[model samples]
Target: MVTATADFVVPDELLAHEPPEARGVPRDAVRMLVSTPSAQRHQLFRDLPTVLRPGDLLVVNTSATLPAAVPTLDGHVIHFSTCRADGTWLVEPRLAGRAGAPTVGPLDTAVAGQRFALRGGGSVTLLSPYSQGRLWVAALSFDDVPGYLSRHGSPIRYSYVPRSWPLSAYQTVFATEPGSAEMPSAGRPFTDRIVTRLVSAGVQVAPIVLHTGVASAEGHERPYPEWFSVPASTARAVASAQRVIAVGTTVVRALETTGGAAGSGWTDLVVTPERGVRVVDGLLTGFHEPHASHLDLLAAVAGPGLVSTSYAAALAAGYRWHEFGDVNLLLSEHDVREV
Candidate 1:
């Protein structure tokens, strides 16, 4: 089963440069595109609880977003992607902007064993290149890693974001563990009101932890191993669920890594068309970049045809894209849908 390919021209205007709040709208006010095997429709995100039926379970990622980008005095920033059990971190160095945003670049001047001072009295020593010369294995020296980072580090930003936003804007309502480098953006549309509506509608919300790595990668690059945890209770809930709806790609990857068991570990599970998902009956996720490896995971759930059609409809409807963008709910046609 080869991965399906499609061409999409995302207009520059469709890019979500800031949160919905900045645009004078609530978080749940974003649009949602619902795609099944036979049909597709557009709806508001706040209507999700009404759309899903009773006994359905929504699996969410509780891994919190980290202010991982640490700027240095030398005009460079170190992005903390993932941490190893041995206390080493997988990091990337990029050119620092005047306003604290990062422009992706190679650390051409970085050498193993070289130490550089950070802006807020910490230091990082390069150990070696990790993958394709874009990431590094570095050791950090700080009194309190979390505290120091809170004072100095900023959320990782890409060129699509016009300016820097607060770290709170990158977080979701379900975020609990502070480990992920980037937001589990699919869950961002859920608000307290949405959660209440879901519970009142008899939908169960389960949480799993997957500390995400850097998301800004070249088109062909696959995701690296990231730390994940699936508790026994969540696994049991998944087993008994009438429909298991994964809230994000991170949740799908973490649940699949469990293999019907429950524990914590690192996973490099790249969901593709050939390697279809087993534990998820559906998925609620945000719009992704074209030709990105994430599109393969979406293809696995919705199939290539539905994936392509849904994206076209979303684009035509003026939906936003990226972390702060609109959402897509891909479900099986045979499920017991309500709306």
Candidate 2:
């Protein structure tokens, strides 16, 4: 039987606990590890413009990170994952044990019909179970969720993060729409200066929207359906570009779900080795956890052999992991050679 790349072991020490800004570095100062079929190259994230050619079109996700974690009076936190068409949301309730402790774990409480009083004025009523466990379909009492979150919610964080960060620290420079439960972190290394340099080098940057859901996953679980949109202009640029470089796995999913055409919908597409990619030529993403389903998408684009080598190289170099971590650029063998 073939093994999945998701079974790899990532060292806990490599998990980045703070943003670069906290470490006294600029947004684009993170390390970038470029991977190809034949070789790997270590470079700074600021070197992106010099690395790619003029005709390469970079596709980015514009969905902003939401301050989706609402604390309750009882010490439990409610995470707003995704908002459904009916105005209700899919949420997960977690017990925040204490400071410097795990914030989310197995939730054993029954939520149906239970009303949670948030720190803010409004309340959340649990409607029903959205899945097997941990998640529920719930309604918000407030009329405007965005405005409420701005005033009361904090960025969703786990134990690894140790402390909370402002929502502005979670947002990318390209973020324009507010929806993602987590940051589109691949774009975290980008800055206005970096973008200007890329444009000066003739690299075209385009936006696609993929309102990402929660990042926490059950062991070996496949990706859940998330809303995505590929506009006509982005589709055209992707079709005409010499190379279509996706900024994250979200971009890969959105572009591939439409088969490079213009469309919008919820997609449960899993880009595995068996179900190889069709549109994206390369990917720029952060280092993910070992055994993460995201690794399957990387394998589908760069092949499992190269993915393994790249992971090994990244670990050997003590590269950081998580949303505020280092980045990986997966391009073709020829593209790497050209750089």
Candidate 3:
């Protein structure tokens, strides 16, 4: 595992608290910081058609966000993270009132075998610690999980966002398959119009499925295995494209897991400078928090020198951060040596 060391403090004011739509900004109009080893340029996300070459393939994740936060009767929120192959779930329990409060961590008192009644009719019994003591393997008593969430769950939110938003706000234009605990937010800035423009400009777009689990923002933990699938068509595109630009780190994980070949299954692959990227040529992703594991993936694709330079430029230019914030497009430079 590669440890990220992109140390830099983000001013609290730069954290986007709501979607661009709420701020009267069109999704495709959000600012994008385009960076390469040699230079950086500020542009709008809608200018993607001009940034990418005609034969370049843009890989996007189509995993839809789930309203994964379900409130319990005793005032706790259960964030259903991932469904194990055995039909159980990995969950994180947070005290309801304090859950969304900034800088507060999830409840750590949940012991194995403890049960909590859901607001509806079912109960979740904590089975064991899933990872790092932050998430638990839970046995859910409810059936038709999707229906239950549609009725009782809201989008999993944090304190940075002051109000609840509709699930639509958490989805991207490419979203179709529903399973991700949180949005693969890097794709959130895309719009149908922008996609049309990309196609008109001859840039190719392909879809992959990678259902992301709950984020490890607070803990900065390494990502766990998540389900992903690369279709035969996309794999063929990747093999032939002049460049392969992954729309999000999720796509990078999926494509790299299969080494550009078509396949599907759980992947624990973590792209780092040591394991450098093999198929992806560039990355179009949202600005991540300081020291995020996502930064390691960026370094793997573009090298640490370019990643650091790009982030410094973004911060100096007051670019926003987080899922709802602005984006960064990091292109590989053949002349720049990886650190």
Candidate 4:
């Protein structure tokens, strides 16, 4: 309903179809554009570990990408989350069709716990089903969303990242959450080694879960609406840490959600300038397009000109867009001057 378009237009060549041949030496090895409430600075992604000090806590979304969308036979698409799978899973089912009168639908050709029987003997199964047809609230499990996607499903895909990639490639080095369709791409370059180094360097690390649906692009230009929750430990870490650096927009939303006046709930909180930000001190994220709701959240916290200027720099410098590309790291002016 809140349909809109990005203010800036990305050149066809700027879109990244895949990551570098190998994950970079430092997951954060890519170039980083540093923005703050005060001024602008340019740096590399690897410089991130050093940019912030020991007391600065890095908050990462441990939410895993969920491979919940699968095609059905009768035109009824079954969308579900994979909980567990030994070739079987509890899945949330959705009849992705006209939200009205149903003709035969895809039910006739749909099988609950078995593969749809592709052209060959190959098959995919919606192993588990929810209490009803509620995909969002369903407690569905599958052998493995990751495993199945490797075999049949695509990267909890969307038009943004524009190409099918192995699920492993889609994940961030610190990925532990198994419910995101797409990896928190901003964190994609943060490989295990980088994370280890950050830990050794005294940068505190904490996890929050946010099961991201697909990319925000598919949701009619709406803000990324994800299922997120902060653990007590994470909550505590955030409250006590001298600095909180969100790994990506998703983590930002999750962390900010917990800090809100209402506290926490099943948040469909679409962060915007009006809603404003509370907990995040700095952010490491992909360069979102102009007018993106995520950008609004950025503006809410980082200021409109700040994000806009940083984005312009990112674009001018030929920084890649989407997951599988370079990154932008923003620190608060208050911290920038201190460092």
Candidate 5:
């Protein structure tokens, strides 16, 4: 197993409190830190088309965000993580604050068969422990999960964001399938204009589907297995591309799991510096927490040295952090040739 330690401290000020659109900044106008083997450069996200070669393939996730957080009568919030093949769900229960923000709740005291009443006339019974007791295997009383969520659920909110935002704010232009618990945030910055420019510049863009689960705010927790699908056309595009640039860690996980093949299933593959990567040549992702596991994937693609240097630059430049923050484009020197 590959593990990562927290290498630096992220100041509280760097956290983005709201989306750029709320602050009068266009989504595509957000700052971008471009890191290559030779140098690091500061640019706007709108300049993405100029940063890549014509034949470079940009792989993006097409999973849309779901309003997965439902409030319980006991003042706890249930975050629906993922659905199992057997039809049960993996969920995390968090304490709801007075202002409606959520914090990590006690999972140790939760017992199997314990049931919590939902606000909208349903209940969830805890079936077993999942992910080493960090989450629970839950069986919802409602038969239509999506329909129930649409009527009673809101987008999951953490303490950083003081108020709730609409579901539209959590979606990307490429979203076609609805299943992800959270947004594939790296693609959040891409607008119709930028995609048009990229296509006009001959940068091929393809879609992969990866339904992301709820993010673990705890320390050093490895990512759980999530659902993904790589279509035949995307696989072919990846195999023949001059370079494959993944738009997020989710895309990297999907592509690396399939190794440029067309397939669909759950992926538990975690990209680490030791394991490295085979299908991805570059990555465009949002800034992560100092100790986030996503950093390991970035290091695997671009090397630890480049990842460290680029992060330091981003910190020094006062770049924002989190889903609604600035972005980093890491162009790796070690392409598929090394594989």
Candidate 6:
């Protein structure tokens, strides 16, 4: 057996910062390479529905991405940026989160001890701009915090991403609730049109809420604890489905967190071979960094061979990594799912 360690090396060029310009297609359109745990093979994303027979079920996380990055008078600040079960985003930042109240000028002009009145007079004290651009965590009153932000805040955005895309672009077609730091980008390619096609073609879609904090790509600390709820109906639907096609890692995490382990609320359930997985028949996820903790989870589910083959194919084929990049897919050869 090959011992696995979270120690793989990754090339920086593999990272993606923008979505593909094409539309009316499966969000899973990014270069997809299919392989097995023991042997590598080739497959296409469009063949996804065809790969499954009648009893297979498809499970997906629908936790919508929030506009966690907000523009204050100073510039743009980010927050809750907790990563969901998937390696995608649902950025939900608090006004007083790391960045303090924004100043009236550029981030360079803002410094410690500076105070600014928020949209609702919820005053804040500037702490630091270590983030470089325009982010600072400040002290503020708790009054109407969410309300104030909803009114004055635009989604948090980073400069490197270029072209301020709307909050909608960061989500899957089945998005629900506002809990993610950013959208689970692997699901982004799943527009309404694609969902219709998949459903009509005998695919089952289910939704769950795993309020993701931020993108780990931001290079922050381990995800702050986020909440996950699996209603009885959704649980039954997933348990009964023939195949579980997870939209991204978040959905996989949420479903696995529920099966076998009987708990709810904030879960720090990081997936590895030790923990293993009980749910999710297949995965529709973005290419991830080599040796990433998220990679551990995927390898656990897809197995090293399937993961390695698929990922190897993705890399060789130039699939992008991260929320805005293309996607990768994995399916069991044995007929485990029902159509």
Whole-model Cα lDDT of every candidate shown, in order? 0.85, 0.85, 0.87, 0.62, 0.86, 0.59
| Model 3 lDDT tens row, 1-339 | 333336788898888999999999999999998888678988899888988877889999999999998888888788989877778888898867655443245888889999999987988999998776679989999867777888888898887787778999999999999999999999999989999989998899999999988888653575677989999999999999989999999999999999999999989998888999999999999888776788888999988888888888988999988889999999975442221
lDDT per residue as tens, model 6, 1-339: 222423345466666655665333445555555544444444545556655555555666677766555543443343524433433322222333234332222335566667654444445566544344434445554444345556665554443354556666676777777666667666676657656667787777767777765444332234345678766767777767766767778877787887823346777777765677788777778776544567767776777656766765666766666777766767666533322
Candidate 2 TM-score to native: 0.94
| True lDDT of residue 134, candidate 3 | 79
State residue 274's C-alpha deviation in candidate 1, in Å: 1.1
C-alpha displacement of 227 in model 4, angstroms? 2.5
Query: Model 5 Cα displacement at 122 (Å)?
Result: 1.8
Q: How far is candidate 2 from the true structure (C-alpha RMSD, Å)?
A: 2.0
- List, in order, the clash count of every candidate structure: 0, 1, 0, 25, 0, 44
Q: Model 5 — which ten-residue stretch has the worst lDDT?
A: 330-339
lDDT of 1 by residue, 168-230 (tens): 999999999998889999999999999999999999998999999888556776568899999
- List RMSD in Å for every model shown: 1.9, 2.0, 3.1, 7.5, 3.1, 6.6
lDDT of 2 by residue, 1-339 (tens): 122455667788888889988999888989999888777889889989988988999999999999988888877888888877777888888887685454766465856998889996778889998766777888888868878888988898887888878889899999999989999999999999999999999999999999998885665654567888999999999889989999999999999899999999888888888889899989999988766778888988888887888888998998999998999999975655344
lDDT string for model 5 (267-288, tens) is: 9998989999999999999988
Q: Decide which is better by TM-score, 3 or 4.
A: 3
